[model samples]
Target: MSNDNDIRHGRHCVFLMHVHLVFVTKYRREVFTKEILDDLRPMLASVCRDFEAELVEFDGEDDHVHLLVNYPPKVSVSNLVNSLKGVSSRMIRKKNYPSIRKKLWGGALWSPSYFAGSCGGAPIAVIRQYIEQQQTPH
Candidate 1:
């Protein structure tokens, strides 16, 4: 079990951080099947581990995937995203070249851009309540 603080005792400092990542398929094509999604989870988890980060959660539909990752401050989010995308792209291509090639057409598995956001801050309940109480135009 981990704490909200995610405080890691490194030689120089302690830090805790998380990020939500989204990767879309090239041309927004629907290429992922149930078997592919299943294969992707572990592949992504392995990538995260290689980066010294943790894959908190991984799920998505046919054209994209959402990954919740806990990473240290030393790692840049963009770099992580690039590595994740690059490695997975190659691996998936090698494994499922025929199907992926047919769908993507450009030999690219993922689009150039991705979405990444920091996670783990204020409690979810508190944030939900704050949102729920917001006054909106009727």
Candidate 2:
């Protein structure tokens, strides 16, 4: 249901790639507070901006965060995730929140693994039907 305007333009291609990402805290500790989540929003947004991507949506519970990012094809998902985790962890640790520090004894804010899924487009069945309807060249 997206319009042409929803597509992004690049020097060599047009794209509309979005990924839903989830990052959990190390050991799934319930360390996040409202104030901490508020601070994290801008930090994550800044990291997205660095890769020429947009963080379309972001939210989290006490132990994890979710981000919907619209990124260009040139950027790899793993790389983006790494930067997001690294920067946010370093910055948050720098803040020295007593509650978070005490819970995260291992020194890493996020767990080593994360979830990434492609989103924001027509269903695969619809696309498949469209492809099947294409006329063949004689």
Candidate 3:
């Protein structure tokens, strides 16, 4: 079945593709506290929306963040990463996450890098299912 809302530009446009992206704090900085995560949550969501991606799932263990995103083929991984890192860094810095500021030192909180892989096929469906089950019951 086709998902019309997912279409971009026009009917002849390509179907949206999905990817799972993982970004880490520089040198694994332990900055993903509950408070910090809360602070960044909405910002990340808005940015992802602007990029035509959904931040379907996200979590971190102080050092790294794992995000499940569904993006169009037109959205490059580098562009998405740049926007997230850039916006988060800017906002977090403005919010005065001292540890992040001290550690990153005008640099980005997320390393200037990321891990991205496709999420599709039957296995991909299984992974998304698992992720759904793992949701924290609101």
Candidate 4:
């Protein structure tokens, strides 16, 4: 009935948006490990589904992670980053991963700030194809 409502309930179309999400470890500490990364995937995917987005790919070094996601038109990039930050921090801390909890400095696994951006107009399918091509053969 209102413009705000219209914007909020817009159609869910495949817009092929590319968002770069950077999540820093709490206190800028190096906490990530392969064991922890294995556990984080499903949790992030569930949140993405709720936001009408898809986590296309994800990777991390010790201190931060980069996520490539396809977000729908109605989702706010800020809100999406918050969910990823807040939820991952809470979940990882609860798991008692020592490196994470120790450097977290207050039972937090991630920093509050994150990075997000548009795709810079690159075609999504083409990008995905290129990424796929770079993978090593099993």
Candidate 5:
């Protein structure tokens, strides 16, 4: 394996873990402005750092955000998502309440549910082909 594919070493184990996360706004509201999305990236990075993870990529549409994250074996995905959503929601709302409140009238920024998927470093084309080839049992 090349250096790029080498596993990460923790105190007693070696592993590679990555996740793709999507967070949507409450009621699927289109509440995020360009400024809010820009501000959110750093906040997410900071949250990832707090969990000893790295935020690999961040982008989103007006109502949802997509994140690619690299995390260790010790971290729980659910817990990380909770923290990320909670902290970012609080901070963004605190700083941009006027804009946010207009769309998210309940004062909550994110919906309770979010989308998360594990990534195994496979090429997207390969994954798409594999999925497309799956068939139902007779």
Candidate 6:
């Protein structure tokens, strides 16, 4: 069971959904610097806000970024990913970091593919055991 505070109450439903998302740079280019990642954090948060979600955590390496987002059930992961990639890409490119632009010949910032995993809550084994112990109705 989740803590009561952790659960979110919507107008007609309750949910607590989190996704760990990983986005790699186009062609796996190493373009992000500390300054770039700093700038990116707020951009991602803003995008999440637009979707009525919260960006709980964010970090990145030169080649990729990881985001932990808490979202409502109404928001689809695909749509959120699209907005995150699109908005951040445009914003980053607009800054015109010569090193980044040079490395990425194409205008695209992220690869077409991404990794998203549902996170938080009990481990699968625990859930399985609990289900197995349940009493069946006659």
Writing each residue's lDDT as its tens digit, candidate 3 over 43-121 gives 8888989987777777777888777777777788889988988998888888887667776665567787789997654
- Model 6, clash count? 0
* Model 3 lDDT on a 0 to 1 scale: 0.76
- Cα lDDT tens digits, model 6, 29-129, are 99999999999999999999999899988999999999999999999999999999999999999999986889997779999999999999888999999
Worst 10 residues of 3 by lDDT: 1-10
- RMSD to true structure for each model, in Å: 7.0, 2.4, 10.4, 11.9, 6.4, 2.6
Q: Using Cα atoms with residue i matched to residue i, what is each candidate's TM-score against the true structure?
A: 0.81, 0.94, 0.74, 0.75, 0.82, 0.93
Q: Model 2, range 80-135, lDDT digits (tens) per residue?
A: 99999999999999999987989988669999999999987899999999999999
Model 1 clash pairs are none
lDDT of each: 0.85, 0.93, 0.76, 0.76, 0.88, 0.93
Please give the ranking of all candidate structures by TM-score, highest first, separated by commas: 2, 6, 5, 1, 4, 3
User: Candidate 5 — which residues are off by over 4 angstroms?
Assistant: 1-6, 122-138
RMSD of 5: 6.4
Which stretches in model 3 have alpha-carbon errors above 4 Å? 1-10, 14-16, 123-138
lDDT of 4 by residue, 1-138 (tens): 122112222455535456878888767788889889878888898889899777878888888888988777788998898898788778877889877656667656777778877763557898899888896979
Off by over 4 Å in 2: 1-5
lDDT of 5 by residue, 1-138 (tens): 234345778999888788999999999998888999999999999999998888888999999999988889999999999999999988998896566888787557999999999887778999899999999689
lDDT string, candidate 1, 38-93, tens digits:
88889898988888888888899989999999887788899999989988888888
Model 5: lDDT to the true structure: 0.88
Cα deviation at 62, candidate 6, in Å, is 0.5
In every candidate, how many clashes are there? 0, 0, 0, 0, 0, 0
Considering every candidate listed, which one attains the maximal TM-score? 2
Candidate 1 residue 66 Cα shift, in angstroms, is 0.2
